[model samples]
Structure formats: structure tokens, C-alpha cells
Target: MGPDGVDKKILLNAFNMNSVGHICHGLWTHPRDQSADYARLDYWVKLAQTLERGKFDGLFLADVIGANDVYGASPDAALLQSVQVPINDPIVLISAMAYATRHLGFGVTANLTYERPYLLARRFSTLDHLTGGRIGWNIVTGYLDSAARAMGLTEQIRHDDRYDMADDYLDLVYKLWEGSWEDDAVVRDARNGRFTDPAKVHRIRHDGPFYQLDAIHLCEPSPQRTPVLYQAGGSPRGRAFAARHAECVFTNSLTVDLTRSIVADLRRRAVANGRAAEDIKIFSGVIVIVDRTEKAAQEKLREYQRYASPAAGLTHFCASIGVDLSRYGPDEPIEMEGTQAMVAALESITRYNPGRPWTVRRLLELMKLGARNTPIVGSPSQVADQLTAFVRETDVDGFNLMRAVTPESYEDFVDLVVPELQQRGAYKEDYAEGTLRDRLFAGRGGQLPSRHYGRRFRYGAGEWADEAVSRQAGRRGT
Candidate 1:
């Protein structure tokens, strides 16, 4: 039970990416680390099985389309340290992982800026079908100018402008996922010689500012018509967009007050946007380093630090905030300007904590574990106490646990911290029944909630509002 005597369970998702270096930049060099085997399907399959054994809610896969080249205006440093370059597609790894586990959910990140809604809708639906509704999408507008250049654009659109594009993209996808097929559209009737009822399958026609589509969704309705929605934008515009559409929000906070502020703001915005206060589950990114004893944990941390690369972490950070930190002196104040990457990242250093002036020296010290986020290092009890207090005080629903040493880091959490949390009634002993959305929302159902913006595009008993509008536009030759 929580301090309020409420049995509020803390959710967990193993945060990782399909690359040698993920959040912890240089830990791939650790002797026991197995992240280099990321390309192997068996690696993910086994990892999924282990997470399911630990009763984790999901495996959140982070992805990047291009190299981290903002530092020194080249990809050399990132390539040398393997800082999220040479990253494979995250979506391709999920089906195998799902097949290997019964309950663990997969939240795969995909950038909307480079993908077509019509095709992306089909891919997610197919995964939902294969995983028995254990699928989610982390919506992101690409932050890297490298990605934009690779996509044949001169540069990324303005930061807020990308969210505007995403809004239209989501609208188009919602139509394809929810409005294209009614509940009874698919039927196996040998006598009638009909596998589907044509009348029930509606054609989606969207002529939005960023995208235009005039076709039916390719696949039939999966267990969940639309996958669970997640968003990680922390800017004002990002939060507003998330409030309107996201079922879950992923956040990273350097302090409890910041996390509390974010959690409160997200709930307030969700309610303001015509959703319930509990509509969006907020998860903070965290790293935990626990051992059988407090001294042993500290020793382990020291060992991990010897193999960590602070410069590599800086290279990754430079790309994130869209500012090159290499030019700044150790104590010089780094300016936050120019690029359209993650505005929130820049604010964290330059504005969030003014008392402690941020400098290259401070950033390197924070990256002792090769990650910007500080890890909670101690015995199981100590780690559990901090984690429980964090959730209780900040109102964050759970954590997206970043990996420091791949399976070793994950295994330690499951074996040590999970049991401690479970003993305190702060973690689930077993997963609830249903799809990813249903499980996350505690058996609400395998579809988007009735009040969600996506539901507006759903094909219900009467004429969908959009269909009526589309017909009017058609008659006017629009």
C-alpha cells in the first residue's frame, strides 16, 4: 500500500534500443555486457521471456533514423563510441519478442515525420494481430537534422510545426485504423461464401494539410483496432499534443519537483482536453543499480564507471539539445540555441536548475555511468525505498528503466528490486488479463477509450461525422 493506503502498483517497462550503445553510451565495452548481440533475434526473444517472468508491463524500444552528428559537426565521435548510430529498426524485432512471451507488451517508437500514416497503420495492426493485442506506439516527431537530411529535406521543420504535422498524421491514421472497419466486418461464412461484409468496410478519405488519403485500411480489425498511444514530447506544444491523443506519456526528470510538476501538468492538460485525470499514464525514465548489499552496489557502480565514456555521453547530449558542447570550455556556459531537436533537453541544463550553473564539467560528472540520468545505486531495500518514494511523491505511474549493461542490468532489477517492491505491495505479482491497452488501463477493453480523440474517426452505427463532411466536400469537387 502507498502512504495513502491505496494499493497503487508501479508499472515498469525495460527501456532499450536496437543498438550496442543505447542510453548508457560506453557500457557496451563492459566484459559481461551482451548488447553487441542486439542484431540476433534470439537476444530479444530471451529478453522478452525474462521480462515476462519478472511481471514487467512492457519492453519500450527506442529508435533513431540517423546518426548523432551535431557534435563536432560530424558523426565521428558517435561512430567511435557507437552513440545510437548503426541502429536497426525497432519495429522488426517486436513480432519475435511477442511470439516468445505471452503477456509482455512492446512499445515501439516510430517517427511520424518520415512515415506514411496509411502504411504505418497496417504495420501496427499486423503486430497487434500477431501479439494478441500486445502492441503500442511511441509517437515522435524526428529531432535530428540528420534524419531530415536523409529524408531529402533541407532541414527539420520548426519544433512546434512538427507537432502540427503529427496532429494531422494521427488524424489520418485514426481514420484508417478505426473508421475503415466496423466490428462485424470480418466473418468466415462458408455457406454465404463471404469472408467479409463489404458494407461494413468503409473507405477512409482524408485531405489534411500534411497528408491526403483515399482508400480503405489494408488489414482487418485486430484485437485492438488502434494500438496503445504513447508520446515523449516535453515542450509546451508537445504536451498539448499529447494531452489530446496520448494514452501514456514518457518523461525524464532530473528532480522530484520537476517530475511532480510534469505529472500534474499532464493530468491537468488531459482534463482540459476533455479526458479524465487518469487518462494518461505518466512514466519517468530511470536507471537503477542494485546488489545484494549496499557496499557491493557501490563497488559495482565503480566497476561500471571505469568502462564508461563521458565524452561519448557528451556527444549524445550535444545532438539531443541541438547544440555542440565541444566548443565550450569546461566551466563555460553552453548556449541553448539553433537546432530544432529536443527543446526540453536544452531547458533542463540551461533553465531548469539555475542555482547550479550547468557546464561541460558538470555534464561529464553526471555521465559517470555513461548516461545523463543518475542511477539509484544501493542494496535492494534502499533502491526500493527510493523508487517507491519517487512514485508516491511525483505521481508518476511507473518507470521506463534504462539499461546500463543490457541483460545484466535487467536481470538484477528483476531478481533484486522487483521482489523488494512486490514485498511492499508496490509492484504487481502478476499481469492483468487483456490487450496492452486493457492491461495498462486495468481491463477497460482492447480499444481506444470512448472520449479519446481517435474515437471521433471511428465508424459507428450512424454515418461517421467525417464521412458526412467528406461527402459534402466531394459534391463540391474538393
Candidate 2:
């Protein structure tokens, strides 16, 4: 509970991947683990049901187009450990899981680098329609060099440049999703045998630097024309991009002060982008190992740690921050000159602990608890108290809870921590009404509020008439 005597509810999302072993590394080898069954449809169905039973806000799926080859300058270590490679497409699993539950939302990560905006717009629209608008897109630009190479490129674009491409990409998708069709475009009039009114649907003619679409959107306006935009970019440029476009932002920070600073900066940028500061929601990555007692939780954490792969952790970090940590000495301070990913992370660490210097060894020790995000290991009430304190101190909206083991970690959270939070009124006992956007911003409405920039593009009857006329005149050189 917050100091104001009011319960501070948190938006909870289950962070998972489509691969055998995600951040937990060798936990796939665990006896009771079912992540190896990820290929089977039943695996996802069961997982989705479990999350819904716990009243989770959403199941956030992480995906990667390439292997974790950056660790040893080869894919050998990654292949041996199954660090996010051999991953199936997350989109294919959404509908199957959506079929199993009513209120659980699905946030699937898709790299916008290789995909054309036109195709992606239709794909997400179809998902939103099928899932009853419980769909969210975790927008990402390809980070791994392997991903770029697989896409027929020599190397990935510079970190900041990817965000520039994303800006254009967003513009194109927004046109297709929000501007292509009038709100009243579809009319199933049986007596007249009239379907969609052709005049109501406008063709999107875009001649952008990266993409061009001279056609109407294939799908009709979904319940949420644009799925709830979730972005997990941690760089300065990334935060700026999120501030402008994202409805929800995912981040990782070790300390509450660091999280607070990041959130403040993001909200400030949002305000600068003509969006209200409160329009964006921030969720930090966190792992909770809770039990009936603190001692039991510590025992569980120790047991889970025995399965933890430091090499796998290094591989994951290497891929994400574009740094090969193997080159640095254990005691040496990490040099962050070349990679933006390295610099961003190093800056955060330094900012968080101004007094202490971070060496390669120190960083590795930190990664023992998944990544750099804070890990809470204690009894249900103890964990809840810490979580509430973190939220109040950091000013974050909620958490993206990471799993240390397949279903066990998730099951523990659902069984222990969730009930404690519910009893304290710090977590929702039931889902809210409407779309994922509606559920997240409950009582705010089903659509992006007027404060969001996307709201400007929402087409009403003849809303774009003046702009259309102007564009037509410009084309005619008038």
C-alpha cells in the first residue's frame, strides 16, 4: 500500500519468449520444465490459462530474428544453450492462446526493420480483430548483427538511425490503420446487398523514403485500429521515440532512483511531443521469487541459481547491448566508446551509483538475478511491500515479471504474491472492460485519449476532407 493509505494497483505482464530457454538459460533442462514443449499448441494454451487464472494484464512475448552469436564471436555457445534462437514466430501463437481466454491480452514483439509497414498494419489489424482488441505490438528495430545479416544486410544500422527509420515506419502504419477508412466505412446492409461503402474507404498514397503504399488498408478498423503500442527501448534516442509513439514503455533499472529518472525523462519528452505526461505508461522488468516464508523463498532462489548460466546471461547481454564482454578484464571498467547499447547501459549504472566504479566482474555478479533489473525474493507480503515501495519510489506504472523457470516461477507468483497483492488491494482481482488499451487505461475509454498524438489521426466522417483536397491540389500543382 502507498503512504497515502490508498492501494496502488500495478499492471502485471508475464514476460516470456518462444524459444526453449529464454533468460533463465539452462532451466529448460529442469525436470518439471515444459518450455521444451513450446512447439506444441497445448503448451501455450496452458500457459495462457494460467496467466488468466492469475488475472494478469497481458502475456508479453519476446522474439528474436537471430541467434545470440555475439558472446564468443560465434553461435556455438548460444546454440549449445538455446539462448533465444530456434524461436518460432510469436504471432502464430497469439490466436491459439486468445482462443483459450477471454480477458488476457497478448503483447507480441515484432521487429519493424525487415517488415513493410503496409503488411504489418494489416497483420496487427487482423490480430486486434481476432483477439477482440487484446493485442499489443512491442515495436523493436533489429539489434543483433546476426539479424541484420540474416536480412541480407552486412550489419545493423546505427542505434539512433534505427529509431529514425521507425519514425517513418510509424507514420506509414498510422496512415493505414487510422486514416485509411472512415468510422462508418463498413455497413452490412442486406436489403440493398451493400457491404463496405467504397467512397468511405480512402486509399493511402504514401511516398516515404522507406515504404510506399498506394492502396486502402485490407482490414477494416479494428476495435483498436492501432494495437496498444508497447516499446522497450532503453537508449536516449529510444526513450525519445517511445515518448512520441508508445502507449506503454518497458525498461530495466537496478535502482529505484534510476527508474525514477528514466520515467521522469520519458514523461518530459512526451510532454514536449504534444502528449500529456500521464498518457504514457512505464513498466520495468522485475523478477519475484516469493513463498510462504522468506526462508523458503531464499531456498528457492538458491536452487534456481544453481541452474543459472552465467555464459548464457553474458550471451543475452552481448546481443542486446551490442557488446562483447568477453574482451574485457574482470576487474577492468567497461569501456563504452563504440556501441550505443554499451554506453546507454554504462551511463545508467554510473548514474545509479555515482560513488562506485562498475567493472566487468561487478556487472557479471549483477546479471545473476536475470538481467540488471531489481529482483525481489521473500515472502508474499514482504515481496508485495517491496513492490509497492518500488512503485511509489520509482513512479513506474507496473512491472514485466521475468520467469526464472518455465511455469514454476510464474506459478509461484500467481499462487503466493498475487494473492497478497490482491488482499492489500495493490493488484486487480479482475480484468477491466474493453480492449487492452481500455483495460490499461480503465475508466479512460476504449480509444487512445485525446492527449495521445495517435488520436489526431483517428478518422471521423469527412474528417480529412480539407487535407485530401489540399493534397489533390498540390498534386495538380495548383
lDDT winner among the candidates?
A: 1
Clashing pairs in 2: none
The deviation in Å at residue 170 for candidate 1 is 0.4
Flag regions of model 1 displaced more than 4 Å: 3-6, 461-463, 469-478
lDDT of 2 by residue, 270-323 (tens): 999988887888898888888899999999878877777766777787777777
How do the residues 224-272 of candidate 1 rate in per-residue lDDT, one tens digit apiece? 9999999999988999999999998999979899889989999999999
For each candidate, what is the lDDT? 0.91, 0.83
Query: Ten-residue segment with the worst summed lDDT in candidate 2?
Result: 340-349
Q: Give each prediction's root-mean-square deviation over alpha carbons.
A: 2.1, 2.2
